[model samples]
Target: MSWHKHLDTSWFRSDYAAAAMPHDENGCVTGNYWLAWPPYITDDKSDPGSLDKILRRRFKTLEAAMAHVDKAWPLGEETT
Candidate 1:
């Protein structure tokens, strides 16, 4: 019942570029996810499935990693 369990790690393989559009003028564009690691950090766009590697590499298991993230940052009230 953690965030990682709910994640489809397959989403992280290809890197993603920030939207070409600029962030809000206040720089308050919210509810976004970004790279905390590589392949992600690289100019090369991440493969959609590469995120699994990140979880496997960092948390040893998807559930543990996801739980940590959830504790640190719970989902928004309207998130679903």
Candidate 2:
């Protein structure tokens, strides 16, 4: 069993911006998943590029990506 075996390639958003594994013409999960933020990256009005630095900008697994996202914005922590 693998991550792709249970998921499809679709760009969706949650507390973060968008993230998904890219797919090939044959509809296969071709590579690692990518993460992205809105054009205006200053979510906390701190540093616009800070979040990207936290993300490492890539992931080989969805769980890893999610773990990083959690690190980026921890529970009970308020950005606003």
Candidate 3:
């Protein structure tokens, strides 16, 4: 059986939301469930560059992605 799931990433849908691309266990890209935000100047006066400029991390399962997000950005926390 194949495990499939979808995650809601609308909360972080700013100009710096992380990209979430789903992939199968076999390492094949299934679909793009989330769209990354474009590049913009941050308040620190530093350009973090666009999402395209960085290597996007692919997740084989929604749980893995959720864990990564939680670790990177905890709930009820403000992000820059």
What TM-score, computed on C-alpha atoms, does each candidate reach? 0.28, 0.42, 0.39
lDDT of 2: 0.49
Question: lDDT tens string, model 3, 31-60?
Answer: 755333222324342433334432345455
Better candidate number, 1 or 3, judged by TM-score: 3
lDDT of each: 0.31, 0.49, 0.42
Q: Tell me the TM-score of model 2.
A: 0.42
lDDT of 2 by residue, 1-80 (tens): 11222245544334333446666787787766655333235545445335655255677666665455455555345554
Off by over 4 Å in 1: 1-8, 11-57, 77-80
Best-to-worst order by lDDT is: 2, 3, 1
Q: How displaced is residue 59 in candidate 2, in Å?
A: 0.6
Worst 10 residues of 1 by lDDT: 13-22
- lDDT by residue for model 1 (1-80), tens: 21221123312212221111113555552323322223223233353224553333344443444444444334432211
The clash count of every prediction, one per candidate, is 14, 0, 0
| lDDT of candidate 3 at residue 16, scale 0 to 100 | 38
